[model samples]
Target: MVKNHSSLLQNKEFQYFIIATTILDLGKKLSWVALSWFVYQITGSALSVGIVISASTISPLIASIIAGGILDSYNRKNIIVIENIIRGLILSLIPILFWIDALDLWSIVVVVSINGMLSSFTNIGSRTILPSLVNKNQLESANAIVSMTSQFGYLIGPSIGGFSVALFGEPMTLFFNVLCFFIAAFLYSLIPTESYQSQNHQKTNVLSTDNRMRKFFFDTKEGMTFLLKFKPVLFIAFITFFFNLTYSPFETMLPIYVKDILLTGPESLGFMWTAFAIGAFLGSLLWVKIKRTFIYSYALGLIIILWGITPTFFVYFSNIYMIYTLMFIGGIVYAPYNIISPTIQQILIPNDKRGRVLGVIGLIGGLGFPIGVYFSGMLAEFLGASTIILGSGVLTILLGICVIIHPSLRFSQMTNLDNIKENL
Candidate 1:
């Protein structure tokens, strides 16, 4: 890890990339809290939370499929820079509309929908660029660092956003969000050109004008084809889908649970999320210590199961501190997967197909999130959030157990590329 950090810092380009990513992540985290609060404040309905999230979901799903192709067809650095600029401008509008008293629910939805589309493009550009920035052996460390940074953002951004919402109202919080984006954009400008490649840099389109979409589909097909050849990668993606599904209700409806059932206000609800973020950040740091251990998957499964089940108990008990403790405890297991999953992929996948395969993983992962959020929300309306969350835990535990029963799906003791290849 030290060696990886040294190399990452020694590379001037990567230094800039780190700054850019860290800053952008800050904005991303803050916007998450800000938007959710904005929606809840405006609509005061639980289902409205689902509607707000749908804004992000609809466009990103469509854009993510295309983003993989774009990743393969463009200069990734340019894409990153451009996307940030666009996102900055778009997000700025939110504050402007709010200040003008013209910000309606529909307007917020429209802006966020655009935000999601741009985010897909931005995510693809950045994720694909990582392999090019660092040595293959260091990919795991680099990914770990990135995951850690993200958790750090989660740690700080929501707390700050919550405070901002309380002190300055939602519009000013959004205005600060715009500033964060520009800061990210400026940092992105400092990254060197050597760190990235244009996928089809000089190649002209060979497909007929009408066949462009067909060609795009065929390109996406290549990513799916690669994953189809790898069982571990497929299993991981499948497990991630279910695991993510289990976690979605917390993000989408947990605030409502805190507010309605537990009688906690927005500030207190934000603190609960902050508690989750703190756990996640600490958990991310722990990845550096146990990264080589064989118990990684088992630990992850246990933590996730806790994530699902703990809320059930907390909701009934209505003890905020207990819920907060569980949230933090859950974080310990939560953060490593972010580190390990990407690490597993980097080790397992060749550079040639990493973009496409990761894109497919993103697509599959993406599908699970909205499905989880929407379904859990609907279920909460029919049953209760506690049942939906608890059931999700049970489902995740069962899924992991099933995967473990298949020896092939179990985590291997392999460490490096040679062992990974031999194991696979």
Candidate 2:
């Protein structure tokens, strides 16, 4: 059956899904920026920032498995709508809690952790369902559009979040985030039933069983088996995992690094992150152009190295303008990896197993943060943020070299979509 994707985009339900999701993402980013700043302000410590981030990410990292199972089982549209409402309600309280001085450090951690779990589940469902809405041929373009919106949100969200915190405070930012979620939830309710209904019945016959746990494990096994046979996917997963281990520290510890080493404030941190996001935005927009000029794998490795090392040098230089420029450049290189990694998964992995395989990727790649944050925070406490960043830079550059040396990784299952379709 040939689906009319343009018509689908014009469909009220699809529009709701896209717009609502975009708004939800904006709020999520805003809250995250606010949370980071709030923690840093109160504790006056970099380690505290790392700790809050680690706590928030921990649940999502753990929930990826179960979240995948749920995503595969549930009516995804309903799952997303319900999750957004719940997310909004929970986040709305932060401001009230803060107003009364009732919000403690532990309370923030607990709330953010719960938020992460729900957010992860919603993401799993939303991403799993997107391809079902559009024609197969549109997958790359669709993914690019989604990535573009993400970059746009990142581009604006941090700046707004930063300035909002300066003018309004953490609670007000949290309140604004709650508003975005409400809007998202409302918009999600309008998606057409036809686009989502067919898959439900189709999957039911295969997935319906007496023992869900047994089926869950079986599903997980299938996804793992698929990855085992596909050399490119496996290598990319490992590369993403290690690269994340090096780069995750920047997000977790970068603000703290700016504050502690550079003796800057929230506005400074905001500009720095905005720079990173802008760079990412530029990189994502250049996806088509870069695909022509560079080998995606090798180029991605080099980007990771540049991203890691540039900030190290910029921090040493201590000019905020230079730091922003370098961060922007780093982000430019960093964007393609995000696009390429997920596109590869969608292109290679079977549709039925996407939830679990993506979960596996999330599980493996996500572990980098808690690990990075824990160690980086500990190191920053004793040695300093600069030394830790320099070490990360050296590690990323070495990892890139190692990847280049291995031919299996360097040239594994080269991604040519036309050939992939032909084989299928």
Candidate 3:
């Protein structure tokens, strides 16, 4: 197993994929920190910050409708490369417009919306392409590596973004984000073209436009149908929906919490995120070694329960160091879910239908994010950020308990897909 893991790491294509993922995620985290802070600074409203953050999600939900069919039919590598480059180009306008003093909240929303729509394609493409990059035995390890390294971006980006915004300004920070995307695109482009050729690549001859449209819809339906029948994946997606709904507020409310509750600035916010990222990074490393011992569903339930309990303590402790400690602990419990859940999907879903099924699942799972973001902002406005966060945490604990006791999920042991399927 160790030799195989080493070999998986040695594979040049996988290396490029991991590097590109890290850099791309770094850019995204940086942009998010900068944008969130920038919006808050300009408007001084938690509602406005939520609106801008939620704008990024709205288009992605709309795009997921057909994103599956597109992924299944086209080269995922090309999709990722093209989307990254386009996103980079689109984001460049932010810095430019800001410098010229023409950037407005509405324009920022529009740009973020466009970028979010493009990102859904690349995000799904990256996940659906992962199984092809390593051997079956290496899948779990690859996921661990991906999760760990990706957290490296989270570890560094927010800190850099906060300081950069403080020192240079939001415009300059955004320009650096633009550069990261372009560089990541270049890394992705370096992966051999033939490596990720779509197995379900559809070649249309002289079919009429109407016929093609029908075919596309038919393909989409087929994928959705399969996902409905796959009880384990469906159950997981159901859990994810609530998980995202409850957890998303943390993103929208964090800056507000920093400014209003903690009475601090961007640097403290950056440090808070960095603390969480550090813990998550460490957890990912540890999870890779110990993941074989636990049942999948039970482990996830316990992790979520711990994750929920950690943040609730924040309501009692307002000290900067205490908050950072809670976030670090929260990140540790949070890391495994990110690694294990996706690996489960990869193991269960067929390669040909992976894109469409995952796309629909993503759409389903993501349904709650924008709602959570929008409402959390509103709730925070009335209830206060700390109060809202406490409520969210308590609600999440209940959800985790539900997961632990649920018959369909609790019996699912960390074993082969066939065993897991039977247990479900």
Candidate 4:
């Protein structure tokens, strides 16, 4: 049955969240092309691109951990709105520096790190807000809407960014991103926090610096204690660690993939991304309808296997159209993992401790990815991008197969949300 997605928009609060997220997605997509091209052009070295991007990845991980305290303690709505404005102002520096031809590599690295950390600081609140905005029955549907809008932006933004670089340059592309963040922030400001149902029951005094630091560590410890008792969360942590570890090398190697293996430019890269987004859009929509009977843990392993095998063929495909088709197919398998993992966290974790628990999940994935990125950079330099990516892909498939046979994951599947809430 075709679900009425329009009804989702009529819920004013969820509507506001979606609008803000969609705007941010557009900016993020534009920045991916514009900034990558700008850095590569300026430095003429793939290793430099790896360093800047790895910094962006690592900084955000650390911020999410630190922001755990803020998400559980402070006024989340106020922080998000203020953070968005700050992020916009910080990002505006890129275009300004580009205009003056004063964009140095180290300066760009610093800007990306600062922006990454602050951006994650704000997003922790928004990420945990979906359960409050929508009814439980509609949670999957709401996540699907989020995915669709985000992919819709990806479908449009990258092509425009890639073309605009040849037309108006990276400065104009970055300028577009600057506008999106500010506008998204305003839309966020309209959300009424009086309606926020999530709250931390424990009180902490933020008055003294020493007490505040102590409080932050205590809050984090409390969340970690709760997480340790839950086996499913640990299951996710295990797979996510391996998943991000294997996935990182491929991500860090993408520029070389598009350039060397595919023998293409940004336009082709844009087309590949558009294909991935379209698949994700449709896959997310499909999951909402099918998630009732879904075996959450089993499906996760299967998705990983599909992801691993698809890329093996992708690297071998000679025709560009064939490569695009494989990328699109890969995206469909990939979308379910993104939707399921977060939805389960939102469902199982207590609203009060959700921030820190999510922070823990972020730390696990983050730790693996940067380590993968660092080694991938060195490995790709010695072994070539093809060998590095292919090795990662094959190992991921084996890991998924091992997960399929594992007693923990096979038995870890939740019977129902009612059972889940009772256990949790």
- Best by the lDDT measure: 3
> By the TM-score metric, which is better: model 2 or model 3?
3
- CA lDDT, candidate 1, residue 286: 74
lDDT of 2 at 399: 75
- Model 4 misplaced stretches (Cα beyond 4 Å): 1-7, 201-212, 291-294, 411-421
Report the lDDT tens digits of candidate 2 across residue range 287-321.
74434444556766666766666756754677778
**Model 1 whole-model lDDT (C-alpha atoms):** 0.71
Query: Which tens-of-lDDT digit does each residue in 73-164 have in candidate 3?
Result: 76777787888889989998988988899999999999999999998887888888888889877888899889989998989998998899
Question: Model 3, residue 272: what's the lDDT?
Answer: 91
Q: Give stretches of model 3 more than 4 Å off.
A: 202-210, 411-415, 419-424
Deviation in Å, model 3, residue 143 alpha carbon: 0.7
The candidate 2 region of ten consecutive residues with least summed lDDT is 193-202
TM for candidate 2 is 0.89
Could you tell me every candidate's TM-score relative to the true structure?
0.90, 0.89, 0.96, 0.92
In model 3, pairs of residues that clash are none
Query: Please, what is the whole-model Cα lDDT of each candidate in the order they appear?
Result: 0.71, 0.72, 0.85, 0.78
Best by TM-score: 3
Itemize residue pairs with steric clashes in candidate 1: none
Whole-model lDDT for model 3 versus the true structure? 0.85
Error in Å for residue 258 of model 3: 0.7
